[model samples]
Target: MLKNKGKRAYRVLDFLHEHVIAIIIAVVVLAGVISTIAIVKGDVKTSSEKENSIQYEEMSTIYFAMDPVKSLNPLSSQDRDVYYISQLMFSSLFKLNENLNIEPDLVSSYTANSGSGTVSIKLREDAKFSDGSRVTAEDVRYTVSQILRIGDESPYYEYASKIDSVKTSGSYSLTITFENPNDAALDNLVFPIVSSSSYDDSANKIVGSGQYAYDSYDSMKLLKLKPNTYYYGGVPQNRIQFKIIQDKTKTTGLMTTDAITAYVSTAQDADSDAEDKKLKVTKIPSSELEYLGFNFDNKYLAKKEVRQAIALAIDTESLIQDNYGGAGITSDSVYFPGFLGTENKGDFYKQDQKGASELLQKSGFKDSNEDGILEDSKGRDFQLTILVNSNDGSRSDTASSISEALNQIGIKASVKKVSWAEYRSEVRSGDFDLFLGGYQFDKKYDLRSLFSKSNYLGYKNDQILASVKKLETCISAEQQKETYEKLKTMLQEELPYYSLCYKTYSFITVKEFTSTETPTFFDMYRGCDTWKWKKVVVTEQKDDE
Candidate 1:
């Protein structure tokens, strides 16, 4: 048996020696296959773990108000809410920063020829629409053409009317010629640009080169916006969801619940509940100029002395405090506080009842009767009716206060609170002696609409008109500044309109978010991209044995 086993071992050794190279190749191949399978299984496990970790992390969502938007069409809509949404979803040739200064949006650079009244805008090569298509000068020309076609119906028509022609200089450059030189021509170009091929004049959905793209609007209740991957600007992390709740009461209620992440409200609307909910309230200086517009056609108001006296009799500080809840800044000029032409002209026409009375007396108004009411040369009592929009509680209160103050000064004044429609009709028709109205001025600072001969006030001064025309035509900022300074002095002396105050607005957000710096009406989301989410991460403890 030992000999037979020895012979078998010897045979096996000989067979192994003969096939050793082939066996070695087979073993190496099998080892490589096993190693590859192990590596693939390990990679799959690691990928699954990474994906699960990312899925477990929460993505932040931001909610804003969309109730005020009536239409999404940039050319047709003038609603503030619509403007805000357009700012997000549509890219303009230019945009205003937090300082309210015009900056380039789609244009990489621009050149203006003041002598020729032409502007050439060079588009960025990489600027693209939401659909990843390149933005061209033809798109801008098409937008301007559409705005012009709308005529006076579009808010941008005024700007469009200034353009004599829009021609594409190149694939990425556009040259626009104006009929006349305009200092605000670049400022007027801030209107949004839409894709020429996509627009159907339907106001359905907007497609542009803005930072965001329209996703969906659910029956006017909610508006969903997504970051545009093709945006010239980088994409943001949080998705924006705007809730359209028109009722202020309902909006306030949503603030307490998690339904709304942020809301905008007046300071007066920031109640205790907002505090309990730990909302951070931010105040923004409004561009809305609340002033007392006089019907210059009125016999009494047509007299500069009468208007100046009325301006001096009322206390602007007291009126702002009592009527506006001290939520407004006193304004002495038609321009807003930070506007280019705004200045302190030694507080002209301040509350000076004695001066007002002396001025009235010098103007040939006297108390002919013992009734203590001033009368003109014809012995007619100087009774002026002050009209206020009934919809605006603050303006109505201010009108009442002005009437009381005038009555105290022996000038018979009465308050007439009229509906908004009626107030507009009366003011437009010059049917009121005095009216408490507010004007939300555009960034252009064009006063032609308020001071021209065809204006509601019928106020036309040759020197003033000439100054305004010069300011519009002025080529350089220095020249514009010099002209505006002279215009300001003239406006102060003439007292065409009593520039009362600039209103303020309040915005409410969760305590986790910080308020934007120097927010304006046009750029409410100025710093929204920098908003941080205070998220907390939790980890499970491991058992140690």
Candidate 2:
């Protein structure tokens, strides 16, 4: 038995030695498969973690002093705050840059027929709505039609009123014909475009083609905006959050406490202490014209001599020095400084008390009762009330100053402070004798609203109206300049409104959100896409072991 066991062991050893190479090959192949499976599983796990670990590096918030009064719908909203936000959420056929030049936005290119008074716009194929739908000519046509249909109810009616017809030739091309040859037709096309389906229902959900889309609005307190992935301009890196605070006093506190990252204000709202804390304040000349409008229908103001006398009595230089700290540019022309019409520099009306008195006396106004107040021809005291909007302190102060100045010149004047709504109603209804107001002119400098026969002041001058008509459709730069110069001379003589100063707006932001571009009043977020937040991110890596 021992001898047979020994023989079996010897045979087993020989067989093992002969198949060693085949066994080694099998083991090596099995090990290779197992190692590949482990490596793939590890890679999948790392990719999943990386995909799920995205975190916001930084966040930004902006604080606006005024809250939007109505919905964010560009067509229906009349508030300036709404306009600012709408520019972010919607895209227009054209956009006014910081230089106030009209640049293409939604429209890739356009052609204007000067003789035909028609503009052909071709929509960009890449432009898309927030919902990822391609922006078509139908959307542009629908937006303009809605504005026209709403008439005066729509805030954009004034801009679109001249658009006689909007006809689309294809899905991406449209032509806009004007009732007359208006040189400002292209400028007026800056009105924002909405998705054609936005008006399908009564709800105010505005889907636009801008970089940002409306995320939510908590009444007057807050407005949250998110990036639009389909934005043709590319999405901004940081989301924008607008914190609306009607009280201007709390704005500084918000900035100091880091509750808000940015604020847009006038120069009067700037604080030296805030600047010490790395807050940057930038001032830009605004196109807003603050003036005093006269009711031409009033018997006392109807006379050209009386209106001119009043214009001469008020010291606009002192008004600017005292109220604006000599930081504004004063003008007598209806157009703001740097505009085409302002080149004439109508220096007819200046602070000349003697000249004012002479004009008043020639107009048959005298101190009949010797009570320091002038009397009209009929022996009635010459008293006028200057209405001012209570919300604007600078205008209110101007009204008071004018009242005091007029009283010194033997004219009894008073100031009436009223709410903005009441002020508008009174002016529109021709219920006020004189009022302090402001107007934002279009880039084309259209003066029809202030100088035409059917104007806000109920003014009617046939010659001025004709010049305005010619200015609107002149198309020739030289002719337009000549017409505006003539119109400015006529305005200086007429004295329908006393142009005081063009306002300036200051924007304050933290150092972390720095950008090279400066924003203008018309386009506050002009280069918002380039704004960046200062932050660092750390990403974890998988172990190779």
Say which candidate scores most in TM-score.
Answer: 1
lDDT of each: 0.76, 0.76
- Candidate 1: clashing pairs of residues: none
Tens-digit per-residue lDDT, 1-545, candidate 2: 99999999999999989999998999999988887787778743533344324333565544344564666677877777777778888898987655444568988878877578888889899998888888999999999988887788776787899888899988999998888775445667888898887554245567888988878878767778888999988777767787777776567567655576666666554645457666777766677888888888888899999888888898887887787755456665767564452342433577898899999999999998898899989999999999999998888988999999888888889999999999989888898888999888766566776765667788888898878776665244456567767877887888788887777676777656677777777777766666765432446655554
| lDDT value, candidate 1, whole model | 0.76
lDDT (tens digit, per residue) of candidate 1 on 1-545? 99999999999999999999999999999988887787778743422233212112333777776665667787888776776777777888877665344568998988877668788889988888888888999999999999999888787887778888899977898888888875435777888898988886776587888888888887558888888888888886668888887765566567555466666565554645576667666666677888888877778788888888888999988887798876677765776565553454434678999989988999999999879899999999989999888999888889999999899778999999889999889888888888888888776667776777888887879899878776554244556667777887788778888877777777666555653353566676665654654422345443333
Model 1 error, position 515 (Å): 3.7
| CA displacement after TM-score superposition, residue 177 of candidate 2 (Å) | 3.2
Clashes of 1: 0
